[model samples]
Each structure stands twice: as C-alpha cells, then as structure tokens.
Target: MTQRTNVVVIGGGQAGLAAGYHLRRLGIEHVILDAQAAPGGAWQHTWDSLRLFSPAQYSSLPGRLMPSQEGELYPDAAHVVGYLADYEKRYELPVQRGVRVSAVHRDGAQLRVEGDADDWRARAVVSSTGTWTRPFIPAVSGRREFTGRQLHTVQYQAPAEFTGQRVVVVGGGNSGAHIAADLAHAGVDLTWVTQRPPRYLADDIDGRALFDVATARRRALEAGHTDTGGVASLGDIVAIPPVRAARDAGLLRAKPMFTRLTTTGVEWADGTRADVDAVIWCTGFRPALAPFASLRLRATWGHIATAGTRALDEPRLHLLGYGDWTGPAPATLIGVGRRPARETARQIRELLA
Candidate 1:
C-alpha cells in the first residue's frame, strides 16, 4: 500500500523534526521517515563523553528549549539524545522509525519516497539525512596495510580500549580534537594530526557566537560582499572544557598530517615516524544523499543545489540540515529550526496552493 502525505520528510532527526513542526503548524500533512530504530538520530551514535559547544538553553528547537542537564554546563551526548526523544514526543511529530529510504524519484507531479517497509508519495519531499553515516577517511598510502587498529568517529564509543595505548587522532575538526582529548585524558600516548595547524576558537566563544558570525557572513554574501569565511575565520575547533584543559596541559597539541601510513604506524615527509597502536579518523563526512541518487540533483560539492531550501533541478524537493549550502548554519540545531524548516514549509505551502 502506498502512503500519501502532503509532504514526506526523508529523515526524522533534528532537521526532519523541525520541518515537521512547521509543516504541522501550516496545516500541511506530512510524515517523517527515519532510518534509526529509535530517537536521538546521530546523537545516539556519538561518543559517551561528547559535549555540546553551548549550553542547553542556547541549543534548542523551534518551540522548546533543551532542558539543562543537572550539574552540567555543557550537556553530554546522552542528554542530547534524551532531549531529542522528548522533543519528538512533545511535538507529536509523525515519525516512522526504522524506515530506511532507498530512493526518491518522480511519479507524475508527486515525489515518491521508497523505503524498506513503506512507500510515501507526496507533493513535496524534504531530504534531511545528515552526514553521520557517510564518514570520510583520506586515501593515504598503506592505510589498508597498517597493522594498528583503525576506526572512524561513528565507530568510537568511550576511550576504554585505547587507554595506555599509543594512538594517533587524525583530522583537525571538533571531533578530532575532542577524541584526542578523551584519549589523552585517559593517559594514552597520543599524537594529534591535522592537515594544517589546528585553529582554536577563543575561550569565550561558543556555538552561539559561531551562529551569529555565520548569519553575518551569509547576509554579507547575499548583499554582494566578498566572503568573510564566517566562523571559519575564528577557528575550526571550539574550545570546549575538556578540549581546553587538554590543550592547556599540552595533551591536545596537534602535529602536521603524516605523509603515509606504514605497516607499524606512520611516516612523515621528513625522516620522522611514529609507531602507534591505533589511528582514529575524525575525518568528517559527506552528505547522505544516496537515497536521492535517482534524481541526480547533487552539485559538484556533493550537496543539492538549492535556492533557499528548494532544489533547483527538482522543485518538488527541499533539502534541510546538510549545511550552509542549504541555509545559514542549517546543520546545527538552532539553525535548522530558525531558517530552513520554517522557510521550506512556507515554500511548500505556497507551491501546493
């Protein structure tokens, strides 16, 4: 049986939930299809110690503020999971769990979202599958041959297994820095590697500041000004408490990326080498656009080309939470709710009318 909705949201994470909120308020019937078995989305898979860059009050959805975790200045991953679960229930969003969408294609004037156990045809489709599942590791020489254990951010949990072991953490982003700090705090022999020198945001800066900077940058670009690089100009890594402490203690110091992986460990361009027991690749991810493969809508940067949130190639589709390409700070919790969701829903309503 084909399930029909006015709008079909192809992910039930933060982005999809936010879209559902606005679509409901606009009286547009919609269903959110989620691949995860339960709530929390990507937060369910994050390391146990992972902390938000800002306080709970600053990291909220459209209608509700995330409740502060007792005794926590910046909430942990578990707290985020709880918040997402509660948010879904509070909003009564129509989310169907464990529905892994395989493809989205045109069917007459409507778009069809085909999933493992169900099908949804709708006048509009919002694809919000964020990048957690599609992690990227650079193609360094001998990576496959490295005798040491290797894992990506998705596979990592607590730092128990790596304690006291020689570990190399790759990538300069927040994930890389956080994981490196976790390992270092555990007394591991840790080497942090990045393509360039790791840039740290000021101690006073947080997610709220980053969001403001990003908003300014977007507005400037829209007004025909040169790109100012926004939050990037400040730094790549946010100085969260643990990361800050680790950096102050010299535990989070980063080295230049190694030239290649070796059988035992890694070798640098110079005669330098390190024998590490494990290499954790915090290398980041590509947008999870595989389900939209039928549409061939991705641009050169691997995201759908869009005007605001609507796809250029397929006007029936809107993309949310992928990144700035979708909207300013669209990938963040506050950003997803503030801009993309509301705008996308309004556009859908206009189109249907």
Candidate 2:
C-alpha cells in the first residue's frame, strides 16, 4: 500500500529542511525522506575540520538563524549538524530518516516516490538531495595502475590520516585548498594538483560576498537588465583562515594536473613522474538526481529546466539545492539557497488552492 501526501521532499539537509519549512508554513501536508539516521543533511558527513566560509548569521535556513559560538569565526560541521537538528525540531518538520528513496515517477498528475520500505504518492515532489553523496573524481589515464591509496573528499575526515605520507590533493575548489593546507600543516608531504590555477578571491572576500554577487546577478536578470559582466564566481575558493595561513606560508602552491596515474603516483604532462602515497580528489559532484530519473523531465547542460524553482516541463516538480539553475544561490548556506523552496511551496499552494 502506498501512503499519500500533498508533497514529498527528498533529503533532510539544508535544502530539504528549507522545503519542509515552507510547505509546513503553507499548510501543505508533506513528508521529508532522509537517508541519514540523524536530522542534519550532508553536514553530518563532512570532515571534522570543515567550517562554513560565511559567518553563522549568514548561514541560515528560511526561518531561524544559525547561532555562532563565542570567538568562533565560522561554525564547524558539528555546529551546523546540531543546528539543523534543532531547526527541524523547532519547526516540527515531518522527516523520516533512514529511508533511501530509489526513484520518483509520474503517476498521472501526481508523483510516486518509492523508497526502501515506504512509498509516497504526492501531488508534488521537491528533490533536495544535494551533491555531497556523489563526489566526482576525474578520470585520468592509467588510473587503475596507481598503486597509491586514493580517496575522495567525501571520505576525507582528517589530515592525520595521511600523516607522513606524500599525498596529491586534486581539484581547484575550496575543499581542495583546505585539505591541501590542512595536510601541509599536519606534516604530510602534500602536492596540490589542479586542472587550472585555482582562483582566489580578495582577502576580505568570502562566502557572503559570493552570495551577494550571485544575488545581484539574479536580480538583474529578473529586472530585465543587461548584465554588466565581470561578476566574480562563487566557485572560487575563499581564503579562509587555514587557506590564508597556507598562502602566507607559501604552502598554497598548486601544480598542473598530471596526465596520467602511475604505479606509484602521477605522471606530468611532460612525462615527468612524482612518487606519492595517496591522492585525495576534491573534483566536484553531480546533482543527486538519480532518485528522480523516472520522471523523464528533460535536462539541458546538466540542469533541469526551471522557472523560478518550478519545473518548466513537469507540473509540481521542483529541484532545490542542486545549483544556481534551481535558485540564485541554492547550494550555499548563507546564500539565497532557501529561496527556491519558499517559491516552490508558494507556487504549489497557488496551484492546489
């Protein structure tokens, strides 16, 4: 038997919680399916040292603000996880943990969401499963021949794991820079490998600035104004404390990505080889859209067509926290990530009302 609801939300992380919050406010009956046993979304799985690039005030959901601790510049992962748990409880968002949703399909005008042990039939579905679970690792030649240990940032907990080991940190994002910096400070022989030179924002710039820029761009587009161009991307690594310290110490140096993986380490494009013990890929992740594959909604350039958080091709189908396409700043905690869910909920309510 399949239970039904007004809406079904996939994921219980920041995006899911935001969606659940909005739906609850709209008096919409909804169920949030969470794969994690706990309330926090992907924050629970982040490395122990992971901290938000933005301040606590900036990194909040739709309702309550994320409280910061005394003398804390950026809140750590545990703080975020704890905050999310408290947020859900505070709002009394209905969340079912430990339920892994396999797929969602269109059953007439409604959505049928199938999970491990439960199935939900809902008029609408909000897919908030962010990209944390599916960490991307670039395919390099001779990848299988590498004798050294390899792990993605998804599996990285602490730099101490590679203590005394020569490690190559791959990717040009904040995670790569942070991990490489942490490893260097942890006494690990580390090399930073990037496809392109990692871009760094000004010393004063951080996640908040990134969000501001993105929001401005969105507002410009919405207002039918021509973009002046030269907007900086939020994807550029913010010079957080560790990264800044690493830069000041000249430990933030990065090398071009190697052409191929060698038996021991990696081979440069020039055919030069470096012996190493491990490689930590912080490449990037694809959106966790697998659970919604059956919807058959079209995607162009890896994004589901959306009109302000509402699916352009499918009624009552919305994606949150996937990326900028879903919303102005859907992926960031401090950014306008909460906007998509609120807008989606509003639209669904208007349609159903």
Candidate 3:
C-alpha cells in the first residue's frame, strides 16, 4: 500500500519543522520529508564562524524556547543545528530524511508527491522550503575563464579556509559585508564590489530597528509595489553594529556591480579588474520553485508572485518567509517566521477541513 498522510511537508528545516509541530499540536496527521540527511537546511552548510544577528529571543521555534536568554545574540551555526536536532527529538516529528521530493501533483482531492524511492499521497501539501535553496549568481561573462577559485556564499565556511588569498567579494548584501570583513581580518587581501553604495544603518537606528525597514520594504515589493528596491541600499535601513565597525575600520568599500567573471578574477561595470586568488560570490539566493514550475506562478523578476502568503491564483499554494509578507518587524528574524507559519497552518487546516 502507498504511504498516505493528512499533510506532507517538503524541506525539513525550521519552516517545515514548525509546520509539523503545529500540525501535531492540532492533531493533524502529517509527515515531513527532507532532502538532506539531517535537518537545519542551509545552516548545516553555513560558515562555521557565523553568528545570528538576531537575539536568542527571536530564534525560538513554536513550542520550545531557543536555549538562550533574552537580548543575547543568537548562537552560531552549529548551535542552531544542534537545537534543530533536539527539536526533532523533543517532538518526535515524523521526518523522513534523505528523501528528496521530485515533484508534487494534485490527483483528484489528494496531492501526490514523488520522491527518490516511492510516492506519497497527502490530503494537502505545505511547501516550507523557504527562500534559500537556489543561489543567485548574476550571469557575468568570463566567469568560467577565471582561474581563481570561485565559490558562492552558500559554499563559504570560514576565512581560515581562504587565508593568504587575495579575495574579491561580490555584492553588498549582509553576507558579502560580513564575509569581506571576516576574510580581511584573517590576513587576506579583500575587496568588496557592489553596484551601488549600500546604505549602512546601525543595528538599532534612532530606536527603530534596521530590520523593520527591510521587512517593510520587502512587504511593499511583495504587494506589487516597490520601496527603493528591497533594502539593498543600506542608507534606507539601520546598520548592524558589526557592519558599522567594519565601515569604521575602512575594510568595506562599495565597488561597481558584477559585470563578468574572468579566470584570474572578476571584472566590474566600471572596467576595473581585480586579480583575486578567490572569488566569493555573496550575491544572495532565489526561491527554488523548479519542482512546482508546472503550476502557474505569479512572479516578478524570479521570485514567486503572491499577495502576502497566498498565491495570486492558487490560494492553496502558500509561500512563507518571503521578503516582506509580515511587514517590517516580522520578516527579518526567525521570530517573525512563527506568525506566518501559524497563519498558514490555520489556513491549511481550514482547507483540509
């Protein structure tokens, strides 16, 4: 007999885990299917030295508190992964690891999910894969010609691994700023290249959180409106303390946007070239919706198109963790994620009923 569930959650990271936790609490029968051998999706592969900018209070899952105190800076990647593992144990969430979902299709009133081994039938499907699956590297010419080691931020682990190398970090986002600073401190010659000078804000600016601006901008864009284009320019949002410190140290410089990749290094739009030993593309990520390509997508640029979490056409297919669905306060931290998950779960429950 084919395995069946009330709901099937794809991607067993924080989002999927949260969905499972809520479903169980509501007495909804569900199973979580994760691609990786373990939980903590991108965190499992994040750089070792990285720490959460959000405090511990903002990082907790639905029922359990993140094992830290209020106002304390959240733990590193390892700590987060450990916490996720513990969450799975605590809830005994029925997650099937190592099972990659190939596709999800609707069959009559049920959803059919094909995986590496077998197919699953569920009354409904919650795609909690989140936004970090596909890394966005702009199509720059001569990237393949670059002789230097080129890697995405998703692959970056630590500066110790790139010590003694001349590194060119591309993009001006949070990841790029952090990586450039870290590697430069580790005795590596570093240059950060961004198309536009980012507007840096203090982590707390004028008693208004920087993330609040980001969350607001994201929500605006998601609503088919644009607010100076999604927090790319730091001047619009508050800067984190570390970013301010980096700026004060003169370690961060805004360069032209990426133009092309050469074997020796990267070339910028201004025709400037850097012969880098390593190229760290801290560009950012795109949602992985390839599995659902058959479904009509409401999109702008490459991101999914939805009015808030509800799909424009298909209300059953909801998207969470989008750039601005929760307005300014809830979009930037894990804490904000809970509200959306709760709302989405409620909607899913209603749909199933």
Candidate 4:
C-alpha cells in the first residue's frame, strides 16, 4: 500500500531540507526522501580540502544560523556536514534516508513516488535533487585511450594519492582552481587547464557578493533595464584565501583547453602535448532529474522549465535548488532557504487550500 502525504520532497540535500522546514512551518504534512544513508547530502562526497566561499555566518539556512567554527573563517566540508546534520535534527524534519526515489508518475490526482522498498502518494512532489550525482566530463577524443587515471570532482579526495606524480586538472571553475592548488602543494607537478581564461572575483567577494550580484541582475531585468553585468560579468572564480594565495604565488596558472586526450596526457590542436600522470575533470554537473523523466518536464538545457518553482509542464511538480533556473541562488544553503523554499511551500499551501 502506498503511504499518503501532502507533499513528497525528493533528495534530502539542502534543497530538500529547506522545502521540509517551510512545509512543516505552514502545517503541511510532507516527507523528505534522501538517497544517502546519512545526513550532509552532497557535502559528504566533497573532497576533504573543500571550503565554502562564504563564512559560516553568511552561509546559513532559514530558522537557524550555522555556528562559527572556532578557528576557520571559512568552514570546511566536515563543518558544513555537521551543521546540516544538526539542522535536520533541530527542525525535526521528517527525512527518511537510504530511500532512493526511482520514479515519479501521476497516480490519479496525486503523484506516485516509488522508492526501493516503499511507495508514496503525495498531493504534490517537490524535486530538490541537486546535481552531485551527474558529474559531466566533456568528451575528448582518445579519452578511452588514456592510460592514466581520470576522475571527476565528485571522485576526488585528498591530494596525498597524487604525490610525486605529474597531474593535469581540467576546467576553469572553482573546483579546477582548488584541486590544482591542492595538488600543487602536495608535491605533484600540477597543470590547470581552462577553455577560457579563468576569471577571478575580487579578494573581498564571496558567496554573499555573488548572491547580491545575482539579485541586482534579477532586479534590473524585472525593471525592464539592460543587463547590469550580474555575477558572470564580475568573474567566475571567487578569490578565496587558498585560491588567491595560490594565484599570487603563481601556482594556479591555467592552460588552454586541449583538443583531445592522448595515451599519456592531453594534446592541443596546435599539436602541443603535455605528459601527465592523471587528469582530474573539474567540469560541472547537470541536473539529477533522471527520476523525473516520465514527467517530461525538463527543457533543452536538461533542466525543468519552471515559472518560479512550479514546473511549466507539470503543475504539481516544483523544482528547488537546481540552480538559477529554479529560483535566485536556490542551490546555495542560504539561497534555497531564503526565498525559494518558503515561496514553494506557500504556493503548495495555497494549492492544497
């Protein structure tokens, strides 16, 4: 027999938890289904050296502030993990871990969420599945022929494993910069590669600045004005302490994109080749919307077409914390909790009413 709920939130990451918090506050009965066996969501999978670009005080979800770490201005992955775990308990969120939702389909007027061992019929389905599982590694010719190890950001751990080896880290994003810096200090001959020149935000800029810029852009667009440059125009990479230090010390220089992967390393179109031990793909990820395939809601960009959080194609479906498409900075811990989660819950409450 399928259990019944007012709402069923898939993927108990920050997005899912935020959805739960608001739903409960509005007196909406909901259940959050998380695939992981523990809390921390994607934080559990991040590399040990991963640090938030924002300070603990600035990186909080609604209803609670993330306590400051005694010594660290920017908290590490483990600290965030602890905060998320504690947040789950403090709010008394109804999260069922280890329940990987396989599919969501229409069942009469309700949506049917099928898990491994159980099924739920919810009035509405909130898909908060962020993109940690679907890591994207661009296809370069001869990738299969490469002999050395190749891994994505999700697979990366500590830098000790690559010690004494020549390694190439690909992509221009924060992950690329961070990994290259990490590997550079770990005794590896490290090379960072980017398709375009890496853009670095000012040393003062952090997650708070990014959000404010995004907000300004949205406001400008809404007021029928030209683009105010937004976050993209400012820069892609935030100049965190380690990354900035690495850049200042000349450790984080990035090379141009290679045309293809050779047996040993990458080769440029100009026939320039670099021999390396491993290639770490710091490429980004796509939305984890495989379970929602039956709903036929995703657009050409592999994201659900949404008017606010509501899916344009499926009204009962709301997508949260995927990225800018869902809501303003909804992917961030503060972003999701600040507006999207509350707005989504309010919309759901209205729908139920």
Candidate 5:
C-alpha cells in the first residue's frame, strides 16, 4: 500500500527543509525524504576547511537563525549541519531519513515516489536534491593516461594528505580557490588553472551583499537591461579572510587553462609541459535529477524547465536549490531560496486544498 501525502519534498537539505517548514506552517500534510542517515544534506559532504561566505545571521532559513561559534561570523559546515538537524527536531517536521527515492511519476492526479523500501503517493513533489553528489570534471585529452592521483572537491577531505607534493588545481570557482589555497598552505607546490580571470569582490563584500542585490538583479533582467556592469553576480568569488591571506602570501594566483593532461601533469595551450603529482578538479556540478528521468521534462541544459520554481511542463513538480536558473540564488545558504520555498509550499497547498 502506498502512503499518501499532500506534498513530498525530495531532499532534506536546506531547500527541502525550507519547503517542509512552510508546508507545516500551512497545516499541510507533507514528508521530506532524505537518503542520508543523518541531517546536513550536502553540508556533510563539504571539505573540512569549507566555510559559508555569509555570516550566521545571513545564512539562516525562514524560522531560525543559524548559530556559530561565539566570535565567529561565518558558520562552518558542521555547525550548519547541526542547526539543520535541530531545526527538523524543533518543528517536528516529518522527515524520513535513509529513504532514497528512486523514481517519481504521474499517478492519477497524485505523484508516486518509489523508494528502496517503500512508496509514497503525494499531491505534489518538490525536488531539492542538490548537486554535491554530481561533481563535474571536465574531459581533457590524456586525462585517463595520467598516472597521478586525481580528485574533485567532493572527495577532498583535509589538506594534510597532499603535503610536499606538486599539485595542479583546476577551475576558479569558490571551491577550487579554497582547496588550492588549503593545499598550498599545507606545503604543497600548487599551480591554479582557470578558463577565465577570477573575479574577487572587495573584502567588505560578502554573501550579504550578494543577497541584498538579488531583487535588483531580477528586476534589471526583467526590464531587458543587458549592461550589468556594477551588479555583483551571486556566484562571483568573495574575498574571505583566508583567501585574502593567501593573496597576501602570493599563493592565490591563476594560470591559463591547459590543453591536455600529460602522463605526469598537464600540457598548456602555449605548448609548455609541467610535471605534477596530482590534479584537483573543481569545475562545479549539475543538478541531481536522475531519479526523475521518467518525467522527461529536462531541458538540453540538464535542468527541468521551470516557471518560478514550478516545472513548466509538469505543474505538480517544483525544482528548488539547483541554481539561478530555477530562481535567483536558490542554491545559496542565506540566499533568496526561502521565498521560493515558501511560495512553492503555498502554491502546492492551494492546489491540493
């Protein structure tokens, strides 16, 4: 027998929790399904040195403030994970951990979610399965021929492991920059490679600044204004203290993208070859929507086409926290995700009412 609910949230991460929080407020019958044994969603998978670009206050969900260490501003991954677990407990939100949803499909007017151990029939589904599990490593010729160790940030733990080794860190995103810096500080000979120049905001600009201008950025796009010279992109690199210190020590510098992987290291576009011990790829990720492959609504960009977080082709489905393509800064910790989560719950509540 399939259990029935008004809504089924597809993840237990921040996006899923936010959806559950709002649904509970409306007295809606819903359940958030998490595959992990514990709370923390993607936070549990982040490297130990990773910290939120925003302060605790700026990283909060709707009903609670994320607490950090007494003197600390940005909370680390563990703190955020603990807060999320506590938030679920505090609200008594119906979350069933260890239940990995394998498929979601149309079942009359309700959607059926099949799990490894059971199944659920719900009026609507909110998918917030984030991208951490699907790390991106660009294909370079001879990458398979390289004899050295290669890892993405997904598998990275402490920088202590790469001590005294020559390393090449690829990509210029936040993860790439921090991982490269950490490896460099750990006595590793490091070279940073990027396809383009990395953008670094002023020290004063943090995640808060990015959140503050999200609305303006949305409006500007709606007005068809193309010249967005001064606006800060949500994904633009922030000048955190560690990165700043790395810059001061001249460790956080960039090299142009290399053309191919060599037996030992990489071959640059200029035909120069370098010998390195390992290469850490931090190219980022795509959405984790493989479970809904049967839905057949995914666009060519590997995302389900959505109208305000609502899947355009499937009205009962909503995709959250994938990235800006879904909604402005929905993937961020203290970003503009809450509003969409709240709105998603409200819309589903009305539809199922």
Candidate 6:
C-alpha cells in the first residue's frame, strides 16, 4: 500500500523545514521530500568563502535563534547547513532524503506525488522547493565552442580551486559580486559582466543592518498588498557590505551582458571581447516546476504567481520562499521563511478541517 501523508512538502530547504516544524507543532501529519541527500538547499552549493551579509538576529527560525551573537554578521554556508541539520534534529522532522519528486498531480480530492521510491498521497502540497532550483543561464551564441571551462555560480564551491586562473564572473546579482570578490582576493583574474549597472547599499544604517526592510515587507504582505512599488529590490539588498567591499577593492566592474562564447573566451554586448580561463554564470535561478506542469501555474517572469501565500488560482498549492511573495522582506535570507510557513500551516489547517 502507498504511504499517505496529510501534507507533502516538496523541498527540504529552510522554508520546507519551517513548514514541517509548524505542521508538527499543530500536530499535523506531514512528510518532507527533498531531492538532495541532505538539507540546506542552495547553501550546500554556495562558495566556501561566502558569509551572510545580513546579521544573525534576522537569521533565526520561529522558536530557535541562529546560534550566534545578536549583532554578529550572518553565518557562512557551512554554518547555515549545520544550523538546518540541527533544526531537523531538534524537531525530529520526517524528511525523506534523495527522494526526488518527479511530478505532482491531483487525484480526486488528494494530491499524488510521484518520486523515485514511491508515490505519496496528501491533502495539500507545499512547494517550498523555492525559485532557485534551476540555475538560469542566458543563451549566448557560440557557447558550445568555448574552449575554457564554464560553470554556473551554483556549481561553484571555493575560490581556492580557481587560483591563478583568469575568471569572468557573469551577471550582476549578489552571487556574481560575492564570487568575484572571493576569487579576486584569492589572486584570480576576475571580470564582472553585467548588462545593467548594479545598485549598492551600506551594511548598516544607524547601527542596524537594514533587516527592517524585509520585516516591514513581510508585514505588508500579510495585510494583503501585492506590489512592491516603493520597496528596494534584491539588487538593493546585497549592495551593502561585501558588494561595497568588492567595489572598494577594485575587484568589481560592470560590463555588458555576454553575447557570445568564443573558443578563447566571451564577447560582450558592447562588442568588447575578453580572453578568460573560466566563466562563472551567476545569473540566478528559475523555479523548477516541471514536476507540476499539469497544475495551473500563475507565473510572472517564470516564477510562481501568488497573492500573498496563496496561489493565484490553485489555492491548495502554496509557494513558499518565492521572491516578493510577502513583499520585499520575505524574499531574502532564512528568517523570511518563517512567516510564510506559519501562514501556510494555518491555511492547511483550515483546509483540512
């Protein structure tokens, strides 16, 4: 007989973990399915030198604080993974590792999740898989002909591996800035390519990291507002600290978007060509929704479209950790995942009743 769960969370990242924790608190029967062998979704693939620019106070989950001092700069990728592992252990979350969910579909009043091991039936599905599952690599001409190594920033782990090599870090996002700075410090020839100029901000405003921007946005979303016309964008979020530091160290320079990949290196949109040993595409990621294509997806720019935590049309399917889901605040850091998980758990409880 197929195993059945009251709710099935699609990803085991911070958001999914939070959802599971809340569900357990509510005494709800649920199971978390993750594609990875362990937790910490994107952090597991981040560069070794990365540290959360946001402070530790803003990085905690619902009931637990991220083990650190109040004003300490946020922990690095390894620290994040360790914290997630601890969260899982403390709550005894029932997560099935390596059970890659291939598809999710409605079966009468139940939802069917087909995985490598077996199928699962649940009353509700929380897609906490996030928007970063598939790295978005813009199509460039002659990419296949590139002689040098090329990899997405998601695949990058440490700058020590790229020492003494000329590296072109593509895209203008946080990952590009962070990776470029780390590699430059490690003595790699680094060039940052961006079609548009990047925005920057200070790490602290009046002695506090601008974490209130996120918190404020979360509150706004909970109140039923959708557009973030007045809030700062993600570019504005990562501009502080490390990005500013990268610019100060002369490690970052804005270049045109990559147009073509040549045998020697890359050609920019401005017709400038650079010969580099490797290319790090930090262009960001897309929501991996191939598994649930049959479901009506309210997508904007390839991300799931939702009004607050509820999907546009499919109310039973909720997308947690989506950028701008709860306005400006919930889109960044591990801290924002809590609000959505709590809201989603409440919604699930109401639906199940």
Compared with the true structure, the alpha-carbon lDDT of candidate 4 equals 0.90
C-alpha RMSD in Å of predicted model 4 compared with the true structure: 1.0
- Top lDDT hit: 1
Report, for every candidate in turn, its global Cα lDDT versus the true structure.
0.91, 0.84, 0.72, 0.90, 0.84, 0.76
**How do all models score by TM-score?**
0.98, 0.96, 0.86, 0.98, 0.96, 0.89
TM-score (C-alpha, index-matched) for candidate 5: 0.96
lDDT: worst 10-residue window of model 2: 227-236
Question: How does model 1 fare in lDDT?
Answer: 0.91
How far is each candidate from the true structure, as Cα RMSD in Å? 1.0, 1.5, 3.5, 1.0, 1.7, 2.9
lDDT of 3 by residue, 25-109 (tens): 8788888888899777668988866777666655677888778734446467878888889988899999999988877776777
Local accuracy of candidate 4 as per-residue lDDT tens digits, 200-313 = 988899999888887777778778999887888888888888888889988888889989998998899899999889999999999999899997765978977888899988
User: lDDT by residue for model 5 over 1-353, one digit each (tens)?
Assistant: 58888889999999998888888999998999999899989899888888888889889988988876676777788889999899889989899999989999898888999998889998899998999888888889999999999998899898788887888999887788888888877878899998888777777887787766775666677689873533354445777888878977998889999999989889988899999999999999988998888888858679788888899888999998877666667888655345778778888877886
- Give one digit per residue, the lDDT tens place, for model 2 in 1-353: 68999899888998888888888998999999999998888888888788888899988887898898667888898899889999999999999999999998888878899999978998988888889888888778988998889999999999877877899999888889988888888878889988888888788887677777877888888899987332354346888998899889988789998999989988997989999999999998988888766777888866788887788888788888877777777887755345677788898898777
lDDT of 1 by residue, 130-171 (tens): 999899988999999999899999999988988778989999
For model 3 the local lDDT of residue 200 reads 63
Superposition error at 222 for model 5 (Å): 4.1
Q: Among all windows of ten consecutive residues in candidate 6, which has the lowest summed lDDT? A: 202-211
Q: Model 1 segments beyond 4 Å from truth?
A: none
What's the lDDT of the predicted structure labeled candidate 2?
A: 0.84
Minimal lDDT window, size 10, model 4: 295-304
Relative to the true structure, candidate 2 reaches a TM of 0.96
Task: Provide the lDDT at 254 for model 1.
Answer: 84
